[model samples]
Target: MPLTGLLFAGLAHADIAPTESDWGGTGLLQTPSAQMAQEGELGIEVTHVSPYTRYNFTLQPLPWLEGIFRYTDIDNRAYGPAVLSGDQTYKDKSIDIKVRVWRESHYLPDVAIGIRDVGGTGLFSSEYVVGSKRFGPIEASLGMAWGYMGSRGDIDNPLSIFSSRFNTRPLCGDAVGGQFCSDDYFRGPAALFGGFSYQTPWDPLTLKIEYEGNNYQHEPLGEKLKQDTPVNVGAVFRLNRNVDFSVGFERGNTAMLGITLHTNIAQATPPPKLLDPPPPPRPTTPPQQPPEQVNWADVSRELQNNAGLKVSKIARSGSELIVTGEQTKYLYIAQGIGRAARVLDNHVGPGIDWYTVESTNESLPVVDTSINRHIFDDLLDHQIDLDDFQRSVEQDAPQPRQEEVLYQATPKAFDGGLSLTYAQSMGGPNAFILYQIAANYDAEYHFAPDLWWSGTVSANLVNNYDKFTYTAPSDLPRVRTDIRQYLTSSDITMPNFQLTTAHQLADGLYGMAYAGMLESMFGGVGGETLYRPFGERWALGADINWVKQRGFDQGFTFRDYHIVTGQATLYVDTGVQDVTVAVSAGRYLAGDWGGTIDISREFRNGVRMGAYATLTNVDGRQYGEGSFDKGIYISIPFDLMLPESTVERAGFLWEPLVRDGGARLQKRYSLYTLTDDLDSDNFDDNLQKITY
Candidate 1:
């Protein structure tokens, strides 16, 4: 769909200039001034968009262009998922490059174009564009792009939901043949969309209208498909500088009202003169005798007379009071002020450097008092929700709020998962959907022997149907869905019906094992029991399993398999000042599955390296020359260096890129790799990889 205004709202903010921003992980040269790079101010803006917080980073790259990077995390919204019965999450990390093609200074409206990257399935790298321009009183914008819409689906077949014509069978053949037949397209097929909008300048109002359409020419479903369209119209107003209101309607289905603010960092500073030079070494006057009853009035008046003191009337019901303000000239002044207020300065003024020990200790007593009065209430009120503050640290680092101390915890673990899945037609020519979700979670668990465990769950489901589609010819009554436009009448076929399920399980030596319905399907059971033996880094594990395949499935043969797997793991810990690393390795053996080796290493900075490879051959399979899919996938997530202001002292800009969990400064990065192992007939089988 059109991505207008989605990048930058039409506000009287400084124009975003394009400057080279350092995206830590990737290598790129920094662009300097004079190259039309970003200039002026740099900052982050965050707004609570209901369930999802809108984190927007704005940069004035130039007078005509604005760089806006915004992402929405729906994880904070609902508690669970739809369609799938587990937790579901949707995250949009969009990078919009906006350029102002035309601008008439402060009076003229500016026009800009933006390109956004939308993640999608193979064959189509979803992308869109928006163009906005101003013409005197009527400021309007138009947007258009060619790409599919919606989040990437975790479907067995990528094409099952999107354009099917873009779907091609997975490459199947001998190594050489597979190389030549493999599908080259990984992004989804392209779709087209367009939209436009209009708005006004002062009443500070904005109104816009737009439309979008997608063309499915080569329809991925192997058919000719019609296009789809959606429209939207909306307006936004500035209630004042800090507050804004917006309302919009989309395709007659979605309506929205949004209120937002741009909070300016408040800065309280001492006058430049007092801060630069000492107060003429406070005239060497004879030490005044300490007052007896404290003539508070005359003392207050004299204190007000002190050049460094500021006096203000503090009306009180019982007394006409005066407040004496002492500005701490520096870190040193804080100490002197504290000492002076308690002694020589008390009589001259109701001297109270509340900001020192008193102010800080004041809040402590409030907490202490509440805790003394009602410990449980205090505990509940001050309950440490680490997750809440961790999320807060991620959003606004420099200006972290009260609970930001949670960021000081060390990142103790790194976990990741890789899955290999294959599905095809089986018994009676019916298609089957079979896949396994294998994941690993390993982190330092103990002191001497680091405990770690890895497991995989294999599942296969087969459905027999008369036809894949019902819209086939009358003769093909077996087909359940429409496939008319998907293929030539002669090329269509019927669906076959079959039922199947695969069983998978896992358990610890003392932990409980509950197989439930899984034990009934596979006619066999499989799981592991593990224990930490001598050291925290060492674990002895064993797996017992029985597997049997029977019945008449064409490409499949009935077979029975059994095996006891034994595995021993070792972990070594290395500490370097603040950086720590733990390396672990384990080996397991089974019948046809042979012997598998797993090695993982975690760096203190959040980098993780893991590799799994199988070596032994069984079940009439060749020893070291079988065909198995082995590949390495690496993921490096370094700290996203976002400049922020400290929340406690919001005015001071601090380097919050590298966080120490509230301790010493720390930086984080990660790396991952997956490789294929030889001698495996399953090209997609990751266990056959040599290195990962």
Candidate 2:
């Protein structure tokens, strides 16, 4: 029997399990294949093929969609003398998107359509449609491709039959590289390609054979390459679930090698370490007598040490006891409340049957959590369950009885810390990577309930700023493009020094005002107000700033450039896939009128993946490299990797290109983020952690 017939015959009775390589995405080699990473999975792959090297980061943010960012370097070409004296190789960045058009069934194949280099230079641009089906241990795929992938032009442009415009492709030059070339997409001649992957009995290995479509007749930088044969062979060796190594011989000539590191970001395993002890055991029966009077000072210290809450005041009204405090630790608000309940049970008088815990941050009231003493005791004693307890707890506004003040503790007025800091910038013409390491000192002081001062200073330890010499090619005012100057001009700098005050203006409205040096690039005074009803799905806010650009050394001196910038923003929680969309219209620092849209999805583990884009009145040509500003960001909560719980998080952002247009002030605070716990859904989701 033929190979196809033999594979089909085995499919009838063979029982085979899919392997690690089977789950890796398409385009494993140079040709299009049919496979996809699992949803929520993230992978980073590095591949080398003779004169070209590629670094690819892929994220399956959705089940049926995959987004990829690739940075490719032409090992033989220079970045021009202006950048590193022509010592560094030329690199190009591109984005790829793949969508599963159809999923496989018993009799149907899995089909996918993809576009490569969507908003990048035309060097590696292509579009393809592919399908694959599994038979026993073998999977096969076949596809038609166009653009760079189909440069061989074995078949005429079939689409040209409908319109002659599809017969010819246009070369618009490198200046328009990052703009989406919609007119050129799938417009050139077409070619056919196919591939198959076979899983052997050996568990760690999988073999691949592909028929590449590229003829190598047209190469980037005006070089024509030779192709001996289209057939290529390769094999992948799984190092583990998170890593893989592969090698291939392509075009019957050059050899290719690659390594991939992958993991499901949503399901990452946290480090092994000790956690806080569980809440104290609940009383089994009514107390025989009233509890002894304990020192309030001792109770305050115990609350801070055990529950990670700093008590500001303790008061009683009738049959209720109220504790106003700030949370210093614990990522879940319920955990803090649970521990506090136990502390209060042992300290408060028996007459106080109701407990009200009012939480605050930066001296701002966030939420008031009400707990019935009997319900908490019932739940902790196993007489009631979580759902029952949740139905009894009350979350509402703080209405402190001012008639009596039982106890009040002096708040900590000053705190500071020192740590090492690192900052990086990439994708600019000056260098592929520029970075600085410094010793950072941060301190904060609270003067009043609504006012505070905070500052951060850095002393440079090591850097490569000497290589940052390229000037930005922006026609507008150099609001942000002077970053190279700021980075190189300072060895020691004060990045932030500001005084801020916040107020609860009304029932659902909050306000903040900030002055002094806000960020490294600008010194400004600004005020912002937000209207967000507790637990509402939408919010509205506005901010205005009057600012002057800071000196290159990051000193207090002002620069010639000055402007007033502001924005009116709207935020909506879409309820689908935990996604949130934010839209803002504003006057930017460059005096351009524009708007921005930011969309992000937060996972249950507190990992956020999102992207934002800004479009201004500046013309595409004048906006330079990327036409506009756009980037992707990921925020990871510290508790995901740490044993001790914390509300802190770190963020990483990547912008394809930075220009002067559509730039806004990098403010230090936002009301929406501060008031997150006010959302009832968020509180309810965390109620399971309640123990006391």
Best by the TM-score measure: 2
Residues 540-624 of candidate 1 have per-residue lDDT tens digits of 4443433332222211233343223223333232222211222222222222333444443332222223333333332111221
Candidate 1, TM-score vs. the true structure?
0.28
Q: After superposition, how far is residue 687 of candidate 2 from its true place, in Å?
A: 3.8
- Candidate 1 segments exceeding 4 Å error: 1-65, 73-89, 99-113, 118-130, 148-204, 213-229, 263-692
The lDDT for every candidate, in the order shown, is 0.27, 0.77
| Candidate 2 wrong stretches, greater than 4 Å | 1-26, 32-34, 134-137, 156-164, 172-174, 275-294, 317-320, 352-354, 381-385, 397-405, 680-682
Worst 10 residues of 1 by lDDT: 362-371
The best candidate in terms of lDDT: 2
Report each candidate's C-alpha RMSD, comma-separated, in the order given: 24.1, 6.5
Which ten contiguous residues of candidate 2 have the minimum total lDDT?
1-10
Write model 2 residue lDDT over 360-410, tens digit each, in one string. 767778788989987988888799889999988998865435535677888
